[model samples]
Target: MNAPLDGVVVLDLTRALSGPYCTMLLADLGADVIKVESPAGDSSRRTGPFPQDDAEHLYGGYFQSVNRNKRSVVVDFRSPEGIAAVRRLAAGADVLIENFRAGVMDRMGLSYESLQRDNPRLVYGALRGFGDPRTGASPHVDRPAFDVVVQAMGGLMGITGPPHLPTKVGPGIGDLFPASLLAVGVLAALTDRERTGRGRFVDVAMYDAIVSLCERVVYQHSYNQAVPTGDGNDHPLLCPFGLYRTADGWVTIAAPRDHQWQALAKTLGRPGLGDDPRFATNNARVVVRDQVRAVIEDWTSALPTAEVVDALSAQVPCGPVNSAADIYADPHLRIRDMLVELEQPGSADPVTVAGQPIKFAGAETRAYRRAPLLGEHTAEVLGADAPPTTDR
Candidate 1:
């Protein structure tokens, strides 16, 4: 079935996560995304914590996670012929995405200015570290950044963990966050083009995107002069909003609303505690959060996490903290089609991967194809009309 972006052509010059992820979303919606890789290939292909059976092709789980529904073209960007080929491809493309460091595209003569000169209506998207051309020079411009650096620098790590230690999230949200933001910019540009018949240049810096993610901390710092400290699974402003140990495992309970707090107190058979001077109001409960949590834990620890979750959910608000295994076994996830399986190129059987999160009623957004092998579509993308290649 033809999807929303059926005829849109994207020249993907991005590597690793951010740019590829942006293009992947477009590809999933039926855009023809042609990923242009260097001779060495995307570094993520080799850097993965891979599955045990196949190690030769660098077909790691990490690379597969974000690059489905697109074709790849391995090109030596340094080669004159290859650069010419890319220019030719860009001429007919609707979007061009890249995550090279500041000035890398300009140095290679493939900047937005150069590409737009050839294709005036092309949507140019760039993903960068702290030092984008728009942000001028940064000390870390030359420094290679991963999710960790962006999280640490963008104040995410500063407020992420407990008061004693700052921790980064397990997933590579730094790259993916910017990727999502860049996707928004690309779509917005496309929408604007619909009105004006002109595409626009867009950029998403990892630092800036992470900053947007943690604007609450910035607001507290600015307005309240509060240097936020991590609350160790508990919310600083909300009482009894944290993980509590159950007989079998852990569960999360949150009662921000006064009505919910009253409901929780009644559910725990401690209704009088809700009206107590130190825990009567949300503000009071927040001030004496530890005492309130201790009282709730006393009631919760007697039951298993699932039992506690069931009891609390029936009365107020609570949920069991599910492990990865628990998540995989979850009936709701299966029912919603959140987990899907696809066969890897050259693999014997299908392997489980994440499915598209959005479900537009009229859109055909199925993951019909698997992630492409490196240079798998070099010939197909350039068209069967072009010259054939013997190179593997």
Candidate 2:
């Protein structure tokens, strides 16, 4: 069956994570995405964790994670002919995405105003470290930002981890979050274009996106003037919500509601503790969290994680904190098809990768193509049935 974005065509002038991730979302929905890169290639191509025998191929695991289901075209936009080619490609595209620094596109004569003149129905998606130029410069705008930088500058680092030492999240939360917002903007603009026959600019900033993710901190600060402090192993507002050591491994227990907390107390053979003034309510429990956790840990520390899981399943909400090995061996993941196996393009054995998170009842969800080698589709993308691949 045809997918939702079957007829959509995207001109991807993005490199690295954020832009590529946005296009990949469109491609997964069956859009035809053509990624345009410089002749020197995306810097990510040179990133490590290369394949066994194909060190020459510019295919790094980092690049592959975000670039699947797209064709690639390498063109030197610094040249007059190259600028003309990109404009030609943009003329026929449903969407045009770029993540270059401020003024770079306008300098090359390929800004939204210029491109929209040719393709008025094109959704122009642009992303940067901060809000668009229309907004005044931010303290961190001129300096480059990755996930860690946003985490630090956008208040994520202050609240995460222990009180004395702040820690950044391990993943590319900054890049991925903005990419998700950009994807939503692109789709919204596409929907609007269908009705109005007019395209618009979709801009997203990494800092803004990160701040949105950390909004709960703002809520606490605003409501209580509490100046939220770090809670290393417990929930700030809820009781009995933290990791506990089991006989074999670790497990997390979250008894957020009053009923669940009472039930957890009963399951541990200490129902009377719930009546104690110090542990009577969630707010009070937070004050005596160490005493409450000590009691729960005393129960969990003797049992295996599975036993604890089974007992908690019958009593309250609880689950084991899975490791990579545990997740790989999980039956639930297989049943839900959260992990998928695909045939590798150049290797004999199939490669298993994380599947799409968004599931639709009737729509098929799968990767359309493997990640492209650098300029893998240069000839095909710039070939006949198309205009000359140059501009300026």
Candidate 3:
């Protein structure tokens, strides 16, 4: 099926996690994303969890996973000729994105003002730690940031992890969220440009995005003067909305609603407890959450995790704790096309990466294109004037 962004062109000057991830999404949706790298290539190409049997390490998992479905063109934009080539590309591009600290692009002579002069309908998207000064002034505008830094400073860590010791999340939510937001911004700008005949500058700050993700922190403090802190595995407001220990492993169950509680009570073979005064209403149960935990665990602690899930599963919102191996073994992934296989650059065997979650009903875009090697498309994309491939 033809993708929605079939004819769009994107000039990707960003590297590392956040920027590359945003471009990857656009490419997955069928945008012609041209990843422009420096002489040494994107720094992420060096990060590897390579296959043991591979002889020639073309690139690592970290880079391949995020850079798939795009063409790579290495250009040493530091040289005048290289920057001119990139500028020529910008003149005909639909969107240009970057994650450099503010002022770096201006210094390189490819600022929004310079590029938009050629293409008035060009969407310029900037994803940064503190954001560009052109959009808003930030004290930390010049400072660089990564996933852990934003997670800590953006109120997420304040209300995550154990009570006193705030911990970073397992995935790179800081980078991913801001990247997703930037992708949204690019799409929105493109939509607006169609009507207004002018493209706008889109900016997303990592710190701001993280803080917005934890809106509970804002409402709790504003509405009740409650500066929220991480409450461990238990949800502070919803009783029985947390992890529980099963006989063999753990399962998460959320039965906070009255009907769900009743169903759970019946499932646990304690039907009368559904209407018991102490645990009847949600507010009442919150007050005696410990007793609620004991009641559920008393039933669950005897059953294996699989048995517990089978018993409470569809009736109550419950699921077993899953690991990477569990996800690999789950048939739901294969059925849904949520796991995609790609050629491992150097290994004989292929590798698997998580597939795009966004689905366009009729447009079946399950194209699992392998990521391009550094300057792999330089000759084909840039034509005869292109520098020798060995130069990269």
RMSD of each: 2.3, 2.5, 1.5
lDDT of each: 0.82, 0.82, 0.91
TM-score of each: 0.93, 0.92, 0.97
Model 1: per-residue Cα lDDT over 1-392, one tens digit each: 56888899999998888788888888877899998887678888876545455546557677787888888887778766677778889999999998888888888888788888998899989888874665466667766788889998888888878895888987888988989989889999999999988888888889888999988888888998998867789887788788898898889998977888888988889998767777878888998887887888898899888888888897677888778898899999887787877666445556677777766776544655777787888887666533322334
Candidates by TM-score, descending order: 3, 1, 2
For model 3 the local lDDT of residue 103 reads 91
Error of 3 at 226 (Å): 1.3
Compared with the true structure, model 3 gives a TM-score of 0.97
Inter-residue clash pairs, candidate 3 = none
Better of 2 and 3 by TM-score: 3
Flag the better candidate by TM-score, 1 or 2.
1
What is the number of backbone collisions in each predicted candidate, taken in the order shown?
0, 8, 0
Better of 1 and 3 by TM-score: 3
Off by over 4 Å in 3: 385-392
Cα lDDT tens digits for candidate 3, 48-160 = 98989987877889998999999999887778778888898888899999999899999999999989988899999999999999889999999999999999999988778
Our model 3 lands, by Cα RMSD against the true structure, at 1.5
Residue 150, model 2, lDDT: 81
